[model samples]
Target: MTTSTTPAVKSSEDIVGQKYDRCLADLLVKAGVGFGAGIVASVVLFRRRTWPVALATGFGAGAAYADCDRAFNPARIPGVRVLEKKD
Candidate 1:
């Protein structure tokens, strides 16, 4: 007798949850970096103004949102082809 091995399949909810977690992490990291950069810029070039910090943070968050959108919807990505499975 021979045994057949098959990989475990993840439910849709699990996949979505994982993606959400990843997006959240990315957003945090990017925003943190942007905040730091903004701090440096404010001290070095902006006369310690507060607007740069907010603007940079917003930019980072927007970028993260765009990246998350692309991740959730692959069709939005350019130059990508979606192929159907043939069985």
Candidate 2:
């Protein structure tokens, strides 16, 4: 997800906004591809063995979760932290 600091928004409000956007639904279906580029790029740039590996693993896992959501919607993991905004 992206982060922005807008004074008008509260901490919780930010999460709500993301949730309102169907964060999970949107993230899913990319087959760990949408964000894969970022992971690879970061790893290549920093070249930090520990951090790079960790990020790589995280990206891989996230991609898997997203892919799973596509095949079978990821059951609400709970505490999604998304604010789930109201229209």
TM-score of 2: 0.31
lDDT of 1 by residue, 45-71 (tens): 999999999989988999999999998
Give me the runs in candidate 1 sitting further than 4 Å from their true place. 1-7, 81-87
lDDT of 1 at 81: 90
Spell out the clash pairs found in candidate 2: 15-83, 16-83, 32-63
The candidate that wins on lDDT is 1
All candidates: CA RMSD (Å): 5.0, 13.6
lDDT of each: 0.94, 0.56
Residue-pair clash count for candidate 2:
3
Q: TM-score, each model?
A: 0.82, 0.31
